[model samples]
Target: MSPSSEEKNMKKWKTPLWAAFAAALVVLLSGVAALIYLDELYPVGLGPRQPIPFSHRVHAGVKTISCFMCHSEAPRSSRAGIPPLETCLLCHSRIIRTYPYIARLRGDAALNRPVIWERVNWLPEFVYFDHSMHIQRGIDCGHCHGDVSRMDRVVKARKFQMGFCIQCHRYNRATHDCYTCHR
Candidate 1:
């Protein structure tokens, strides 16, 4: 065969290989970036909308109420208990009755309709996070939940990723076993 023809053949063979490599690289980079984004959303909790604009800073810090007041059973159970209507009414039924939002809450309670608070900062369904255990073990709520008592809107300030949690565990000389977080 002519040398020119051989060179042309080689170029043709290499062209597809290069194209494939480029395509694979694009796919790989895209996947990596997507994973990074998902990691940011690790402890996926409530997204944007919350039922009532409850301010943690006002309720917990200004009022100096304990975390367990709203999450009454947090130290005793896996789930952080949502405050019942009566719980909120305990203060709101009289004190904040003039506030438009509090009036609405009072009306809802009177109607026997519960305020459906959108839970933010939730772990994956497969992952089990026990607030009781964490609280009893002296894991401050601020560690994983950021400074809730300082937040007005309660947006997620921490990336609840497995790696993030594990890093905390490592720093504190705690266990990072799969069983520790995941069910």
Candidate 2:
């Protein structure tokens, strides 16, 4: 083949390769940018809504209640158990019995109706998270949950994306196995 013909063929081949490379780069960068954007918005803390507008600011900050006191089961199970009605009654049974806001709670508990607490935190169905393992490992709840020690209404603070999870594991030199969280 002549030199010019060989060069033309090489250029033609290179064009597709370069285009594929550019496309792949765009996809990779987009995935990374998407992960970053999601991480900022959808954190791994509470979702939204509460039954009685329970303020962590009051209970955790002013009253100094430990996080474990209410989310008492976080260190033991995948699901953090909700505070039983009896737990609330421990204080409201007498402390605020006469207050109109609390009177309804008293009436409901008397009737055995579970308080309809709106859940504030949740993960997507595909991800399997073990609160016990994280807690047992002495991981700071604030790492993924943000500084709820100051929040009134709980909000999602950590974007619980797969990349975010892997990044966190990498930072802590922990295992980032797919089966660890996928199954």
Candidate 3:
């Protein structure tokens, strides 16, 4: 083939290759965005293995314990706080006194050691959420928490990103003022 013909063939191949490259880049970027949305950039990765295997189903379902019974601060505070270890001991001190896990908890309590539980649900630092406000407005815990009473091990049921909260606000006709959440 002539040099001109060779150049024409190269350019033809280059166009298809460039198109393929662009398609691949878009696919890769899309995959990354999906992962970020699903993961929600938690300090602990999805479905974290807690130090002690706590069973929400056993406590909240079988025993009929209210969520606020353990997480007492949720009704009055901005944070749906992690229950202090003493909360567990209230019933555990007698109910399953000799169980290995209960014993371990007893030991930890004796030493006054804190349990650093892996967070199951979280929101970003910039967004301000008041658990008390939501509760007072009659939003169920399962609205964001996905029915922990039914779960043996709690997992993040959905993404807690901006769009998620915005959708709820829109559905409820709540104010979307920037300062309401942004501050």
Candidate 4:
């Protein structure tokens, strides 16, 4: 082909190539923006909907129930165990047994089925956090969990990220070794 014809062919291909590249870039950016929007709508901090709405403000703040009353194992075990249905029934059986949500609790208790409570704060599987250790070290629940007594729906108080935990460890002069948190 002649030089001028080759140049014309190259110009034609360049226009379409640039247009295709721009189109792909727009699509990629749109997808990223959509994911960010969705995340904002349903943030990690916003607590999950439970099977039954249990208010920490009412129980812990208003009623003045001790944290240990519900989480009986916080001080003694690695896992701060979720209270069984019987714990709810202890007061609920007499107080609001007629309420529909309470009635569901009653039904679960009667059938010996556990109420599957949604977990709010969770670390990665590789990260090991002992509730007892923190509790023993005089770390109040609020330190990590935020003001749970004020929250009706217990949302994730803080981002349980590595940097956050590391900062805490450094401040408290706790073991800052990688193995201290990561197993």
Candidate 5:
């Protein structure tokens, strides 16, 4: 065989080295992904990371700011819409104008950017929940959200499992006709 063709044939010969490398990479990546998923499912001493560190302990607890003030849509809408940066700026514009976090908020506000807060509690897409209905029923936010006044970093206090909702409904004497939530 010609020297160049022989060299090309040698290069084309299959080896286990590439296969081993790919297998090792897959195992390593899978382990990392498992750790991340497990951490999210069961956080030991912390909650999920947010883009900003907004504290409920300081805002709702110490400051005694009502939940309605920030979650304005709770009273009238099906979902409680997260307060926009403009709403936060109402107080932050003057309260902590020099703090690094507030300063970042100000910058975003200047550019008309909104802060995206993470939702700690979750409900399945098949289940329909109405914040206004619950609010009208005189159920305080603490019933579902736990005492936010005591929490700095929000964490899920309890799983929103079917049994949890059923129990609450039974105690409150609310309907349990499946359609009440499963709609």
Candidate 6:
């Protein structure tokens, strides 16, 4: 082939190559921007609005209530069950019995109805997280829960992603096998 023809072929190839690189860069940047936007819209800092505005700071921090007081089953069961309305009424029945929110708690207790509290820290259904196992292993609640005594409203402190769990398991020399968590 002629030198000029070769040069023309090279130029044609370079043009498409540069165009493809530019397109790929745009796509990468677009994905990053979309992630940032979604992160802002649904932040980990935001907790769900509970049926009653219960403050962890006031109860756990100020009153010095132990974590086990409200989550009575954490040490014994896989689930840290929400405190029954009767448990709340044990305090509210005498202390703030006239307050509207406390009144609601009182009414619910009277009828033996459970309060539908919104769960804040949630794991995917595939993963099996046992609170009792962690408690028995001497893992502090703060490690996963992040200073509940300090938080007025409980927010997700750590992203609880697979990488986070795997890192913790590997560091602690716990099982990092897929079945350990996935099952």
Which candidate leads in lDDT?
A: 4
RMSD (Å) per prediction: 12.0, 15.4, 10.8, 10.3, 10.2, 12.3
**Model 1 Cα lDDT, one tens digit per residue, 81-117:** 7889889999887796899889888889889998888
Q: Which is the better candidate, 3 or 5, if ranked by lDDT? A: 5
Model 1 pairs whose backbones collide? 45-121, 45-122, 46-120
lDDT at 65, model 3: 91
Over the full model, what C-alpha lDDT does candidate 6 score relative to the true structure?
Answer: 0.88
Candidate 2 residue-wise lDDT at 161 = 80
TM-score of each: 0.70, 0.70, 0.73, 0.74, 0.74, 0.73
The lDDT per prediction is 0.83, 0.80, 0.86, 0.90, 0.88, 0.88
lDDT tens digits, residues 1-183, model 6?
A: 457987888877775668899999999989888887889644556567888899998999999999999999999999999988878878888997789999988888889888898888899999999999999999999999999888877988889999989888888899977998888
Between prediction 3 and prediction 5, which has the larger TM-score? 5
lDDT (tens digit, per residue) of candidate 4 on 1-183 = 456987888877776768899999999989888888888644555577899999999999999999999999999998999999999999998998799999999999999999898999888899999999999999999999999888888999899998899899889999988887788
As a TM-score, model 1 comes out at 0.70
Residues 1-183 of candidate 2: C-alpha lDDT, one tens digit per residue: 457987888877775668799999999989888877888645444446666667787888888888788889999898778887778788888786788768877887899998887765678888899988988988888888788878888787867788888888998788877888888
How far off is residue 80 in model 2, in Å?
A: 1.2
After superposition, which runs of candidate 2 have C-alpha atoms over 4 Å from their true positions? 1-47
Say what the RMSD of model 1 is: 12.0
TM-score of 2: 0.70
- Candidate 1 has its poorest 10 consecutive residues by lDDT at 40-49
Q: Which parts of model 4 are misplaced by more than 4 Å?
A: 1-46
lDDT ranking, best first: 4, 5, 6, 3, 1, 2
Off by over 4 Å in 1: 1-47
